[model samples]
Target: MPVRHRWSAAAFCAFALLALAACGTLNTVSGIFGNQINFTAPQLQRYLNNSFPREFDKLGGLVSATLTNPKLTIPPGDNRLRLDFDVGVRAVGAGEVSRGRFALASSLRYDPATRGLHLQNPEIVSMEVPGSGSLIKGGTRELLNAVLAEYAREEPVYRIDSDLLARLPSGKRIGSTDIENGLVVVHLDR
Candidate 1:
């Protein structure tokens, strides 16, 4: 083989090795410096379960009940309570990444009688970890939990038409009535 060809081959091999080395470092960089590894649903759920209920109990008047209307078309479960929730997640800024907040506003069909809908909130909760990445999987769980806990109960999160509330056998009192002096009970335990 020509000397120039040998040099060229050597240069190509060096570039290939460098490219492989760069690729190999990606997982390690993700491990050490990216938010891709921190989004664990189970872990977040456990944290929320422990942290949120106490906050709820402290914030009086929001009754945690469940849906009992046999004629109503809604998600299954005795804990399907109607409630209003506001969720916010703030990402702590680090390095070149700018910090930001994710917020969600929604009125839920919560059953103050069964408290089933509380489960729905956490299902909507999302978070951004510094290196592990955003916790899109069931981040809503914590977000819902947090929002429900902090919700101001005097006003209905969303207006339930009196007629609709009246349709449920246990309606009006649990549905249209103000949760201000009402109680909010969380049925889903971690």
Candidate 2:
């Protein structure tokens, strides 16, 4: 081989080795950083405000319901999320309609397998249906839970997208979730 070609080949090999070493160092450094993500209440509120209406509108069978003005709050003690919204419900064929405000409190669970935050054990905290009294309130609660269960089965309240998960080092996964000080803190671990 020519001297110039030999020198060029040697330099290319050295550059490749250096590039590989840098990549390895980056991975090592990222692993040591211990990634954790904090999702604030305002962010979650925006997501729910945007998604709840679209999801609720899809349940258009016996009862047609519309959710508007969704308000999210984190209650003290339990790490559950409280969602208050204005609901309008119309029953098909029965000619009965109700418009009122309702609140639902649900416990949050983190599913590592899917990298999503799921709402579980949702309970109707309060419901006001004019003229129908407690009977309609009870029925509304049951209907809401049923509908929410179906929705939750298919979609999580919040999912950590694959792109975000890819940023974490291999083997590092979401560990735990805590709701405090109006924030959802997600821990990541290997």
Candidate 3:
């Protein structure tokens, strides 16, 4: 090949390699999964710690002191519960490549005396983008934020069924009072 032609080929290869690297995939046309911006365990834990306290306080009042108190409320005092959360993208419907989902699983503990609440679980947050390479960081960040908000506001008393309440050892019916009384928790679901 002429010198110019060789240089052109070399440039092309370099560009291709860089492109693959940026996408984090090289095995297929879809490329490696987009780079995942994850919330570190510590980071997520802190967020939950900060948020749950405020949220729980709000939710607890609604549950134990207000008209909405019939719902299961996070106990008062120093209780620590940890949970694992995963956020990822999945194909939800036809003709769509993927939609994001944020999942969380964990335990909650509270102490009425010390007034502390603890959450324990492995938390993960990720995104599911369409197979088409168009993962917009700004949009994803906003979406993640929204999810986080939703997760933070989840209340213990919002979804109780009367029949279920009757079966409870407490013998109290508390599910139907109101759906709008709890804190809002948002996060990316895996």
Top model number, TM-score = 2
1 or 3, greater by lDDT: 1
Instruction: Tell me the spans in candidate 2 whose CA falls farther than 4 Å from its real position.
Output: 1-35, 55-60, 76-78, 112-115
Report lDDT (CA) for all predictions: 0.32, 0.71, 0.32
How well does each candidate superpose onto the true structure, as a TM-score?
0.21, 0.69, 0.24
- Per-residue lDDT over 1-190 for candidate 1, one digit per residue giving the tens place of the 0 to 100 score: 8999999999999999999999876532312112112111222233334433222221242322111111111123322322222222332332222122233323234555432222333232223323334453244344335544455332223332345333433311332211111122211211
Clashes of each: 44, 0, 50
Over all chains combined, what TM-score does candidate 3 have? 0.24
- Candidate 2 lDDT over residue span 1-190, tens digit each: 9999999999999999999999866522312245666675666766676676742533457776677788888876657788788887778786546788888888667887656787777777888777776777777776777766765566566776677677776887787776755567677777
Which candidate would rank higher by TM-score, 1 or 3? 3
Mind giving the per-residue lDDT tens digits that candidate 3 earns over 1-190?
8999999999999999998797763221111112211112333344344333221112322211011111122223312222332333222232222333333333432222322223333133333444435554444345445444444344331122244223433322111111111211211112
